[model samples]
Target: MNGGDPPFAQRIAQVSESHTTRIFTRAQQMRARGRDIISLAVGEPDFDTPAPILHATARALADGRTRYGPVAGEPGLRERLAAGFEGFSADRILVTNGAKQALFSLFQVLCDSGDEVILPRPCWVSFTEQIQLAGARPVLVDTDAGFQLDPDRIAKAVTPRTRAILINSPNNPTGAVYGADALAAVAAIAAEQRVWLIADEAYHVFTYGDRPHVPVLGLSPAPDGVITVRSFSKQFNMTGFRIGYVAAAPSVIQALTRLQSHTTGNVCTFAQYGALAALEMDPALIDRRRVALRRRRDLALGLARALFTCAGAQGAFYIFADVSAHLRAGQSSADLALRLLDAAGVAVVPGEAFHGPGHIRISYGCDSATLGRAFARIKEGIKEGL
Candidate 1:
């Protein structure tokens, strides 16, 4: 073989780095150079992890639970998670490093070459890449104008090779929470068409106003071929804990366990104890945080609407604002994001990353004061067109 040949696997070329993280890294570099930067890019809660959960994790560490754990996760954590969902037993749960790993493993176990997974546009950036990494294709469907699920469009996108349909409620990037009817219709499509329905409920607990998040598995006469993936990250402000779990039929759980055994083995041992404590945490504490986030959402949304046309976020903590008005003819959201970063001293992710090219996603996950300051800078930067 010629030394001139590239040495990477062809599959490695199929995916790109996460645009969100790229923007974050760039912001960090700028900050190191003494530029003041306020980041509204990454979607992570600003709150600290609860004291009870921290104490439990510290206890686990003190007890020397740092060794490798069961491949599927600790029994106590799995049992607690399974108990929350109807018909799920501990055997049906498989914990992983995060919801991301749970998803990657699911794709690896579920997809063969050339298979397709249907995703609604403006999805989390990793969905497309993860599907690609599994040697599967991601078939993207555009959501309705309001960024809500259009089951009809999804139904038309299905073909014989279709493998699964993934839905994220209280969706990322666009903070649109999917309606129950649309979710049920999509579920019906999956069941009737014999495809897997994967629900990524990472932000399920963060909804606002009259719109509460609906779990796909909670549907009465619950549809078959459903898998629910959830995380401890959002609920407990435990993002660094790296603990998330999947609930599916026991066969699927066993298959995932087999795949994970080869990959990450088990989730971190002490972290599982922390996750267990998260479940036992007081409902009032989570409610308090949700209330606070709702207020921040209002503050961010008001600032966002003053600049660009965007729907009021019903869930999650992002405002996906259409910045097309600020772009010159032929300019993209990526350019606008970069201009905002340099000119406004604010960091945001471009819509192109989520397949919504005319917008940018601004996270409201930071404190209220920081969010307000960032948006003010964005306004002035756009006005000056620096």
Candidate 2:
């Protein structure tokens, strides 16, 4: 153990540090230093967890429900969650630590060394790392200029080693919602190629205008080999609860449950009850959140368009703006994001991490007033960059 201890494994050292995390960490540091930093870097709702859910968790703990529960999740919560989709049952749902864990474990089960997962960029930051961790290759294919999925591009990226195709609607970072036609094309491609199709619909409840989040599982005939991953984080402000579930064939659930039995097992026992309470929440409350997010989206988009070229933000509470026009002298998106943090006290995620350089992802989950001020600072910051 000499020489500063043995070197860590190559796998651990070779992984890319998440750029979003870098920005988030820096913002936290600035905040600790008493800086008035406005962080739009983290993908979390600013809203409070609904009161009913909090009370439910409290009640569960009081009832001696703190002990470890089923690895496949509490049957009550699973049954409730499954009720939304026809044919889904508690036996077919395996709740995990988070949608993140569900995704990670799914990849581990689905891919092996050199197996390829077709990913459309700019994607969520974790997809590549998760695929890599599973000993698989993340074959990234860039989206169209408007950030929409081009099925032809996906078709071209597929190969014999392809294990799955991962898609996110109301996607993280870019906030682009893939259209039904495009998803259907992908569904056909997955079935024809005999590969898995994973749909991360974590932001399904936040779609705007005519752009609705379509689950691949709900597609007509619902192509085989499809796995749908969802989380309570965004919709219910349950990020801290860490409850997310996956819906697939019963066989997939069995496999995940087996893996879960060895891994973290069930999510917090009481947290599952909180999630059940969340399901019982009035839909009106959700509508209000969506309304608020839609307004914030507009405010952020208006400010972004004034400074840089950006596509229509259809879903998710983010604006993926192209900052290349304002970038000067070899400044990558990360550099510009850093400059925004330092110069304007505003924090945003660099699009480079999402495989879309010269762009930035601005989360509008902040309050409207905060968003207004942040956007003002962003305008000034971009001006300074020019």
Candidate 3:
């Protein structure tokens, strides 16, 4: 090997590591050194996996479900997932390790060299990197001041190379939920442009207030080119279970299944059983969590608004606040994030990670008391000119 040469594939150079995970790891390291750290970096639910899921997974293991399974998914689980959407059948669903993997596989199967996928900014941290990993380019369109999608901007950004338009509702960092009209417009653009529409609804069930989540597939005469990706992690507290599925046309599902067959075969067999149990969980349980999170969102937003200009977080448990006011001269949001971690004992993902600079994403997924204390420290840190 030549001195100072890069060892990994050249494609690795096109992407960056997830800043959310990096901040999370740094927080863990700080905690290991006995420093008090409150992390609002990763978007994991603070609750445990519901008991019924645990019991079902145990039973599945006891029944010897440890062996290989169908590449598409466990038949029963696929059927149940498909049943959630009108006019969809099991053949249209492809369960994968998580929504992340489903998206990765989708990009791989759909993209070619120089293809482009249009998405609004600031989006989740992984979307851009995932697009680059697939040898496609990520075309980022700016949302309005309220972080709502502008279909006209998306339409303007489209070109011959555009292969897909990816959207997230009850979005990750900004928590902007797209209403049906806006979603339909984007879908129409995709249809007219002959491009695919991929909707990442991982936080679909997490919306609050009157902003009910509108499933992209639930549109009247649902768009045929649409792909919906959902996860069990956020809603059911199944992050470790790594169970998520993609619902699309049967042809798309077949292509993903062919790709997954050469990749991880099936999602963990027993985990799918647990996911099956999650589908049967009490609706009230999820409602209770949503209610609690709404309270936390209010508390966190109140605190954050006092510190910085904030986005209108209509859904999801995040407050994407502009911390540029708190930053020192020449300091980026990343620098401010690190300073907050080292000085304030609070960890937040910097805005640059999500293509939204001069801001930071604060997750309200922690307990109420912890969240209160973390914001208290952050307020003090800003007062001290951090």
Tell me the TM-score of each prediction against the true structure: 0.98, 0.98, 0.98
- TM for candidate 2 is 0.98
Worst ten in a row by lDDT for model 1: 216-225
For every model in order, what is the number of clashing pairs?
A: 0, 0, 0
- Residue runs of model 3 more than 4 Å from their true location after superposition: 1-6, 220-222
Top candidate (lDDT): 3
Please, what are the lDDT tens digits per residue for candidate 3 over residues 40-130? 8879869888999999999999999999999999999999999999888999999999999999999999999999999999999999999
Candidate 1 Cα misplacement greater than 4 A, ranges: 1-6, 220-222
Q: What is each predicted model's overall lDDT from 0 to 1?
A: 0.91, 0.89, 0.92
Candidate 2, superposed: residue stretches over 4 Å from native: 220-222
Tell me which residue pairs clash in candidate 2: none
lDDT of 3: 0.92
- Give lDDT tens digits, candidate 2, residues 1-386: 56788778877775899998889999999999999999988898699999999999999999999898989999999999889878777887889888999999999888889999999999999999989888889999988988888889999999999999999998888889889989889988888888999999999999888588888776735444889899999999999999999988888898888998999977899999999999998999999999988888888888778888998489988788998877878779888898899989999998889998999999889888998899899887766652
What is candidate 1's lDDT per residue for 27-46, written digit by digit as tens? 99999999999999988878
Model 3 pairs in collision? none
